[model samples]
Target: MSTLTLEVVAIDDGVPGIRTLTLASPDRAVLPSFTPGSHIVIQCADGANAYSLTGETTSPREYVVSVLECPQGRGGSRWIHRDLTIGSVIVAHRPRSAFAPVLRASRHLLIAAGIGITPMVSHLRSARRWGRDVRLLYVHRKGRGAYVDEIATLTDSASFFTDRTAFVSELSLELASQPFGTHVYVCGPSQFIDDVVTAATALGWPPSRIHVEHFGGDLAPGDPFEVELSCSGDVFTVESGVSLLESLTARGHAIPNLCHQGVCGECRVPVRAGSVVHRDLYLSDDERRDSMMACVSRGSGRLELEL
Candidate 1:
């Protein structure tokens, strides 16, 4: 639960509606090191928002993250866009990684779309540093791509597309032709990830070889459910519009959490009974069997938790 006080050393409006923040320590200390595809959760004005680290991972003095203003999001990116500026200080958690490089894979195939390119940049940075075999298939809207220029300097094996249909057709061919040890890493909307995973599975790609980066998404207002604390036998009714974590906190129970979006695995609790509608990106299917992330996941029936 440690935190870092970061000073906004610089801000860039180079991309429309996207602000790139360069953060450094006030006393010029070297920041905590992170691996490729790592993200740090920033305490925003509204709530904590997680952004992928797109800066150097080795002995870096500053950390960089690009925030795209999400109109339909839960107001964290809106706060970063409107209120933050140079010389402003913000609090952030140290980098936590869930999407990391597969060191044993023979080759890395990275796929990204729109703001999903944020995490891929960190992946490419690591591939360049250690001479790892890597390729990127980036799909972005016309003239709205982020880090295209930067990614060009890293690897010439990248492919860019503006047409979704063309990209999917090409991706199907690529997925089928990769070598035996090739692994695919993808980041985008939940549906997009599902489509990519489906296509890969159809192409005989093993589940172990397809990695996904699941981050922010608007949670659906699931059916109302109730959870009982196994410790105290106190039950809390989770309403349609409210999350289980929100309900617990509103009832004066403080749960340690970082990303309200379920990308971080901080608020996961052991499930003692009932079924879980797995919505979090941080948990594996095996891990989801007996545990649930209270941030964005919902349950059915009288869910019992070891909370």
Candidate 2:
């Protein structure tokens, strides 16, 4: 993946603990065009965090990303909130999309859970620009959901439900009103995506129409596994409870990784030989047959990587 240098122009608090970062690129050159549900990975002082593109194409050079202060895990969010300042130069990747809007559908139903609102925010903008009918259902824990007012101002009809039961009922009605071709985009935690998929599948929505994006919190670093680097012809033993990427980096091997949570697919490597116990959420079953996400996945016993 190609890396671009960006300068922080401004950072503002959109809601409590959530800040929107405005980045400025050189030459007044425009960034890449991204679909409604696209997200860009930004490298912060500590680590990397993936944020959905909230800025419009007309303002391409000024990329907007919202960060929610995390109390646990890596320092990606907290550093952005506390340490990031104007004139700070950071490395980032251009917009890459996984949960793009389904163009074939005339009507759309967007579901966002908690911080999952990031990607859905861009979808609303794209849908509105194209004049596609859209509705947003935002579900959040009590006192945790942020930016409800901002979302309501931009969407056609926006509703919030703190209670899971009420939220599911309203979501079911929305799901029922639309026909089979309607597109459903789900974003949030693993449980949120799992629940939405289960409910949508039960409601007769095709599996192909439901797209999901995970916002961190995935597999626990598994037991140390063995990896045979095909290119260098060397075997490395990853320590227990350490990610394969970390193990490789600790041994002075150069490899790339972004969202270690398995969503970004930046650290994916091909398997040359041996079996791998795949754990990433991005890859489908068929894709896992020959590849593995080194960031969050581990080998079954010993595996060979094309590296």
Candidate 3:
């Protein structure tokens, strides 16, 4: 788990509640390459929170992430909004992927709302660079979209909506009319994602062709549980206040992980035996029967994990 020390080289508060920060190495070194829709976990004053990279993947010099001030959140967005300034340094993990663009699809149908458009910004950048077939449906308040002009400039097949009812009515037509092999992607609030997914499902879109990304939210502690590593025969107790990732890492288990809030699927472990209290947003119902995301998921009684 390597980390980069990044400096807030630039800040754009032009957008009302959204602040876009540009981070780069203090020495001007090139950053790691990332796929479209990738994100980096930044260390905030409260804890580590994942933000989607909005810059094109081709950029090697810096990473960009937009923060929407959340007074009701778990303090990460609040700290970024109120405390960070140009030249302020912070630590962050390298970019990791969970919601990458499906390059092989016949067409990409991107639907986003509010700050969910952050990841779609990168997706559209790559699609333009490669000349992929894509369409964007962005919904936001009349004057509050973070990258409205930029998105309109990037693609001609974009539609904007400020009215929820209008968007919902248009969504059905849009979902019903896409050509074959059009993979649908949705990113936004849980209810918004559910709406898109449900509409697509009703329209006969296959589950495999739909992708989703959930933003970091305050994680509530779960009941204490224990997990046993089958090979090592080591049992670790996960406290109510601590996550399994924290519990295991504290005991010297170097588990590969990203987005400890459980949106990214990097830290999933196979469940050999026992019942799992699946809490992650990444895994589907079928996948949950065999695996568990160690980041936010828990187990009841003694559980065996293929660690």
Candidate 4:
């Protein structure tokens, strides 16, 4: 991915734990345009972190992103909240979209929780401009909604829920009322996504009509395992607290990688033989049969790779 050195133009608190930042070119150049659900990888002091763009898509001059301070996280969010400031220059990759609206759908349903509401902002804006039928269900803590007021202006069909039971009840009703050809987009914690998907499927929503994006959580290291390269005939033992990608790279193996959180499919390699514990959201069933994302996926005892 190409990098752009942009300056933070503005910063404001979206909620107690979330802060919204506006970034622009230093020389006032028109920045690259992005569609709804697009995200850019920001190079932070600790590591690269991806944030969804939540600004105007048409004739965009700046990219707006919201970051939630994760004190217990991998230090990326903490750096953003504590060190990054207005007028500070930061490097970021060009915007890319893995989750986007299906324009052919008759209607749209957006579900978000906590920081996941970032992308919904962009989706709601575009939906309003196109006059598409859209509804938003924003679930957050009582006072932790990031952009509740701004989102309210985009659509009157929006609803907020704080309790888990109430959220599920409303979600079931919402899914049941939607007509055919309605696309559902969900982004949030793992449990939240799983619950929403389970309810949607039980309500007769097909997997094809359901879209999802994971706001990744910290990946705890798995048990130690050994990996053997098929061609090179070299074996390496991956420690219990280390990732397969990190272990390989430390041993001088050049593995292509980005978004180490497994959202981006940059470090996927062919698995000749192994029982892989797949953790990535990028790969499909067919792909998982032979390949694995080296950055996050791990093996049980031994893994033979074609790389």
TM-score, every prediction: 0.84, 0.77, 0.80, 0.83
Model 4 Cα shift for residue 131 (angstroms): 1.3
State residue 150's C-alpha deviation in candidate 4, in Å: 0.7
What's the CA RMSD of model 2 in angstroms? 4.7
Q: What tens-digit string does per-residue lDDT give for candidate 4 at 25-86? A: 99978888877888888888766788999999866789999999999987888888998889
For candidate 1, write residues 220-239 as lDDT tens digits. Answer: 57789989999999987898
Please report, in order, the local distance difference test score of every candidate based on alpha carbons. Answer: 0.88, 0.78, 0.86, 0.86
- Once model 1 is optimally superposed onto the true structure by TM-score, how far is the C-alpha of residue 289 displaced, in angstroms? 7.0
Better of 2 and 4 by lDDT: 4
Q: Locate the minimum summed-lDDT window of 10 residues in model 2.
A: 214-223
Candidate 4 at 135: error in angstroms? Answer: 1.0
Q: List the residue pairs that clash in candidate 4.
A: none
Ranking by TM-score: 1, 4, 3, 2
lDDT score for residue 303 of model 1: 96
What is the overall TM-score of model 2 with all chains considered together? 0.77
By lDDT rank, best first, the candidates go 1, 4, 3, 2
The candidate that achieves the highest lDDT relative to the unseen native structure: 1
Which stretches in model 4 have alpha-carbon errors above 4 Å?
218-259, 263-266, 270-292, 297-305
